[model samples]
Target: ARKGVAKSEQYEIRREEEEMRSQMSCHSLKKRAVLTTDSGNCTAEEASESEAENSSMDEGDDEEGSHEESEVEVLDEKGFRRTQEKKISNVKQTELKAVEDEEDDDVENLLKEEEEFEEKIDFSADTAGALKWKEDLTQKAAQVFLRQQQSTPNLRKLIYGTVVEDEDRE
Candidate 1:
């Protein structure tokens, strides 16, 4: 019985660690969305569109790997969003400052690129794919949650480790 208990404790600890890692990665994606998306409200519509796009591409993938094209587009959108966010941050800081003529031209060029990128974004297929991706992520997150709940001892230890002994005792 003692050996069984010890083994279970070790398993709990490992599960807790996995859950922690999953939560961190999940929140990192949320943080990226918060930083890149203008408002948190659009996330729902964005997800819906992504799922619709995924549905459309599902049939196409059976053919000559045409669905990979949508996959590439999805990846490109993510990259573009990240890059645009960085450029926007830089532009925001300099908007109120006097800039060199060269800097002004560069900013204009960046703005034009941003506009073109936005115009190229297709909501139909991308939305469906995004929704599918989100559902998969959420499902994984739910599994992590269940694992955390089942390994409550490790969770309690983790929480208590951060608290003062006096507070924890109470």
Candidate 2:
């Protein structure tokens, strides 16, 4: 009795495995059929079926077309022209908006550059202020040299021995 029960269990497992294998083979066959259809390898019957589906869909579109025709009749020529003009104006407005945005960006960039330049100038001014005495030293020396030359009054005479000037004085 124990051996018979074990055999029954094994038989049941084998049956389940066979069922799973059949399901997998069916799934793979369906996938291959889809692949072949998508690759444009469908039969004439499949193509005709797809055409029939498309024709049924187009019949629905025909009802929508009648609604559009009714709406067109409701819109007079003047109203249609006004709508066209509104569309043109909207396009122009969008173009102008884009230009204004670009100009705003350019102005922002310029402002940023100006601020950077001002910062650099401020920094340079601070360093230049610290070195101000060096520039003043040369000017101060030049002034002192000029003052000594003016007070002495005879630099050319000392250097050249004052030939014509001393004779004139004598």
Candidate 3:
């Protein structure tokens, strides 16, 4: 009886181990391989193969003639990308055609707008004279340097007295 009980416990432990092996955390599974199809990442070869499969599926769906928006997610060596396409029905197609016809009338207004943008690239002479302050840049900088030098007292020289500066170390 004791031996049978031990055997049953051992069998239960083995079953638990098998279950743990089969079930894995998402993080561990994804990190197992960089380009494994199981983890939603694929190498270039797998990417092309999947694309071919998608194309065949798309060809079959063409017969259904459903105008629903479709989204496709492509996973490849570079990265993952999702693109969506909306299929236009006859009504939307006619709307687009009408918009294009309206745009034809707006082309002349767009050309006229070009003239407005072309004006005033060179400012009026009135504003040009306002830049007279910037004319003597070098002289202004020199004047500012001298003024600051005269205004801020040299605290070090003032503390030590001028005798140190007046002294000829030579």
Candidate 4:
């Protein structure tokens, strides 16, 4: 009795495993069939999708056409000569907008660079201030040099320009 019960349980488990394997294989085959099937030329869904894509593509062209038509109507009311003037100003507006954006970018960059340079200058000045003796000595040396150059005519001439003889001076 015990052996028979064990055998039945093993058989039930094997059957269930086989059923699951077959169900998976069937599902995979159905998926393969759907992918491989070709119903013929374009279906209604495909045609609709293609039409939607084309309509979207044409939308930009339609916008351009409408703008041109409006311009033509306006020009008809204004006159032909005015059309040329309007076009010239229209073109200038686009060009000027681009130029203004470029100038804004350039100005922004210039201001950033100026801020960075000021930071470096401030840092160097702070460091120089921290060294009181060194800063004073440098200043004194520059002043002494300037005075010596000013007091000596020969030295001043050599430092500045050619020494004028009396005729050249006149």
TM-score (C-alpha, index-matched) for candidate 2: 0.25
Worst 10 residues of 3 by lDDT: 67-76
lDDT of each: 0.49, 0.44, 0.36, 0.42
Model 4 Cα lDDT, one tens digit per residue, 28-76: 5454344322211112112212222333233444334323533363336
Q: What is the lDDT of residue 10 in candidate 2?
A: 82
TM-score of each model, paired residue for residue: 0.25, 0.25, 0.20, 0.24
- Candidate with top lDDT is 1
| Clashes found in each candidate (C-alpha, N, C closer than 3 A) | 13, 0, 0, 0
Tens digits of per-residue lDDT, candidate 1, 110-162, equal 65565445535544435553444545545565565566566666565566675
**Residue-level error in angstroms, candidate 1, position 153:** 26
**Best first by lDDT, ranked:** 1, 2, 4, 3
Better of 2 and 4 by TM-score: 2
lDDT of 3 at 100: 54
Better of 2 and 4 by lDDT: 2
lDDT of 2 at 65: 36
Name the 10 consecutive residues with the lowest summed lDDT in model 4.
39-48
Q: Once superposed on the true structure, which residue ranges of model 3 sit more than 4 Å away at CA?
A: 25-170
Error of 1 at 106 (Å): 25
